[model samples]
Target chain A: MTDMVMYEEEYRQIQEVCARLHRDANASAVLLIDKNGQLISEAGDTGHLDTTSLSSLTAGNVAATGGIASLLKEKEFTGQFHEGEQINVHISIVAQRVILVILFDERSSLGLVRLRVRRASDELSSVFDSLLAKVQQPSTPSIFSEITDEDIDNLFKD
Target chain B: MSFINYSSREINCKIVYYGPGLCGKTTNLQYIYARTNPDAKGKMISLATETERTLFFDFLPLSLGEIRGFKTRFHLYTVPGQVFYDASRKLILKGVDGVVFVADSQIERTEANIESFDNLEHNLYEQGYDLAKIPYVVQYNKRDLPNVAPIAELRDLINPEQVPEFEAVATTGYGVFDTLKAVAKLVLTELKRGR
Candidate 1:
């Protein structure tokens, strides 16, 4: 199992990348979702959207696509764009661990979204690569080791 | 995979509920969704057939307060358990942090239980995850029904490794939270050990 620990600096960097993607692509929202369906960061308009559910479903979609890729003898689908009558979702795989999902309506074109996502994905990939390196360092302390059983029990407290 | 975000001070873990078809996997999620505080849970999503049988999966995102200032969020997923949905089941197991094997307790489905358990092992292995290394628990669901197998029999067959196991009737919420808590606890312990 790989541990994904995102420190403040890395989080800020990812936030900036997502914000830039939202701005440059004129997207409704941009989300950085882990391949396991956790939301790492978000930017732009997500007020009404259920980003949590969206993130989970997005990762599921990516996994299903990956299964198909394997069946076809391809590595994986690094980029996918789904067009809708009004809304569109563009997903790009980053560092093979995280997914960048850009949600847009008629406001943005697929060509522009793809172009911006390419740049943003590269930036996000580098940031996450470094993050993974930091997590992998042997010297990094285990955050859970210090917490007591009581602390864990308290989490279940109402 | 477990994700810890220092910026938000949150730890997110993925827990997948797996078992044979009609083993009460979805019922477990539904019970949790109904009983949990609204602030602690996100909307439940179910992609199911018109008859309400799960087609792809059911997802429920839950936040269990905070541990050492970091919110502990758990994403619960139930894969489609029908035999023909093997591909879908395999996809759902990717990156799973913990697993709850919800076995049907009825004696008539003994073979189905064994077959599904084997399928779970094979699918996890294909994803490069060893079942023994991952935090796992077993739930003997539908215990309220007649002709249920004895707890010892179920344990011997499905839980030979002797990880935490619970008896549950998910529809009425009996033992539902107990099963969830047991698996969640193991997941946290695994995290603490830096797994």
Candidate 2:
């Protein structure tokens, strides 16, 4: 797998899409996580949630479901929903690289969330396409390129 | 695969702990979680059976301070090490930036260690990551046990690549951070080289 490098331009674009989706779907929260369980960006009421754990667990759930799909000779199982008394979670994979999660309660219905996510997923995927191109440019130097061995050692220094 | 977010000035990498059953993979993560400052770590999540054996994986997200202006974060995961959990192991290894193979060092567990090592290599190969190319380390755990094998013997058996290896009693936290720091450093060094 190639490293995922996000630039400011694409990040802003992604943030816009998430924000719009959150508003349009009337969702309580929205999160975009990489398949490796890294939180890329999040929107809505996330301050009270432990997003780190949520991202990791959601990725694990996706990975496990993907495994099950392969066993059945399918490419992947891209969408999952978990309903609860007070909340509901809608999860889907975008461009096979990142997960899109929308959490809603009585304020939003499943149909509305799914409809808004379908549009947001396409927008996010296009943003990622451009981001990937930017990352692949050889002229773009890595931030770590200037780091010295001393820097790494100092991190371990107590 | 590492994720670098310029907007957030954050760098996140995934490191997986792999080994055979009851080999202390989970224990190693537990020690780190308990010892880390609350601000530097998120909640530790263990997807385990009622008996506490890991049903899927254990996850711990840690922030290892900063490198340059970028905040360095690592999501550590421990796969269920039981022999029957091969599918779960492979799933956890996906997108891994580094690996720590926790070997059960007890003499009778020698064969299990080798089998698990081979499994690690095979699973990595399936994902197109060469065992030699990836940032990897070995930890011989259960060193406090009286029946444990010699470190030299264990190294020769599982670590022919001469990768950094540590001796540890995970329950007591010996060599735990040493092993973590070694692999984390290797991962960052590899990232630098990739550029």
Candidate 3:
């Protein structure tokens, strides 16, 4: 968690892509939720944003659907898309460890967001892979594997 | 699969549940744990906030019915649903082999359901997975609820891809086994196909 293990530049690139997506999709917000459903980076904001609840919902989304995907026993999965009336969100897994979420209004077309997000995801993956390599090689504690049982317990310390 | 030791004859697979909050995602896991024989399942851990909401992730290791010579072992994970928890969710999704989507069968929850569903795809892509190629299934939970959407409507709205879909009242254990069976079967089928 020190200064964020992921490089700031990588996130800036994600933000740039997200901002452009927001303009193109005309959506209210674009967010990046990790595999654990933690919001990493976001763009665009409107009134209907609830950070906590939405994060939980998104994580639950990945868990439940991903479970089924495994059950079907087909192959690995890429991502899922949910379309709504006033609000349409597109979520994609970027670096196998990061989730890329984009929220837009009816003005956002699924086609445009899907296309741009795909390109951005490749760049995002390289950045993350590099960052992960740095973390692994340096022998530092990443937010992922570094937390000790004590740390986890302290999270619940009253 | 390299992360797992197959030489030990244990077929370990990472199965993740993906859905929106309050979509019975945890409930589905709970039902699976509750119904499983004590010897077949291991520790069920939930890393949640004081409010009882999942903070980072929840993990449970299960040993399902074995096959041929391999023991079917699965590591089940539930990611934190809050929006800010993307970092944690991505970590949990690493090296996943299968996914289950729990769609709340309520009309009003359509937006949340879709958002959560789309998030699943995004995460999988990062893991180098193809959603269509993955062993996937859909569970329409909360069927006992008053305002729950009909199964047909839920099917039409959520899973137009026509994968293995089931109606689950995860709380009462209805269709829970069906969901598990579908996914496990698919997982094993995939393993066999590779053979």
Candidate 4:
């Protein structure tokens, strides 16, 4: 698979989608993560959470689920839900490239979060499509292409 | 695959530690986690069995400073090294940017080392990655053990590609940072080459 490159335009668009989902779903927090476990963006009350660990574990969960799906000869389990005592989590894959997660308390119901995520997933997919197109264009300069050997060595210097 | 977030000024890469059961893959990560500064590292998560063997994987997120203006973040993972955990191993190899094969250095475990090495290549091939193309390094761990094989013998069997290799005793942290730095350097260099 080719590298996933995120430009400023797409980033802002993703952030907007996540923010809207957070408000509409009444989620305690909303997180968008790459399949590789990188946190792309987050919204709402995440200050108390360990979002980095959450993103990594969520990606692992999706990957393991995808593995089980393949074993059963199914396509993939595109969405999953977990009900907790005080919090509920709704996770869905967006465009097969990123994971969209919604964490809601009693303030929201699973039905509302799922409904809101369907629209947000569509918007996020389209934004990612444009981002992929931009990434594939030969005219788009890669940041790595300009990095020098000295620059790489500098990272290991201390 | 690496993820470059220009908007966030960060580059995220995944590096996996792979080897046979009890080959010290988790120990390598544990040592790194113990040594890293709080500000530069996140919580190290280990999903393991009740017996303490890795069940799925061990994940540690680290910030290896910056290059130019972009922060370089690495998500380090260790696969469940037991032979029966092949399915879990395959899952962890997904989207790996680099690999470190931590071979058990004891002579008795030679076959297991070779088998795990072949498994790494086979799993990567199934995922469309060629062993030769990826930034990879090898570590002959358990070097402090009395029954360990010679480095030269281990190299002949495991380092046919002549990839950067190190002798490590993961428990005491010997050669740990060297192995980490060598692989991380190769990974960054690979990134610089835009692959």
Which ten contiguous residues of candidate 4 chain B have the minimum total lDDT?
B186-195
Q: Could you list the iRMS of every candidate?
A: 1.5, 0.7, 17.1, 1.0
> Please, what are the lDDT tens digits per residue for candidate 4 over residues B1-195?
999999999999999999999999999999999999999999999999999999999999999998879999999999999999999999999999999999999999999999999999999999999999999999999988899999999999888999999989999999899998888888889988863
Instruction: Tell me, by DockQ, which candidate is best.
Output: 2
lDDT of 3 by residue, B148-191 (tens): 87777777767878999988888899988788777766765654
Candidate 1 lDDT over residue span A26-102, tens digit each:
99999999998988899999999899999999999999999899999999989888988878999989988998999
Candidate 2 regions with alpha-carbon error over 4 angstroms: none
- Docking quality tier of model 2: high
TM-score of each: 0.97, 0.99, 0.55, 0.99
CA RMSD (A), model 4: 0.8
Lowest-sum lDDT 10-residue window in model 3 chain A: A149-158
Clashing pairs in 1: none
Proportion of native contacts present in model 2: 0.92
Q: Compute DockQ for each candidate against the true complex.
A: 0.76, 0.91, 0.02, 0.86
Query: How accurate locally is residue A133 in candidate 2, as Cα lDDT from 0 to 100?
Result: 86
Q: Where in model 4 is the C-alpha error above 4 Å?
A: none
Q: Tell me the tens digit of each residue's lDDT in model 1 across B1-195.
A: 888888898899999999999999999999999999999999999999999999999999998888888889999999998999999999899889999999999999999999999999999998799888889999999989989999999988889899999999999999999999989988998888663
Query: Residue B5, candidate 1: how far off, in angstroms?
Result: 0.6
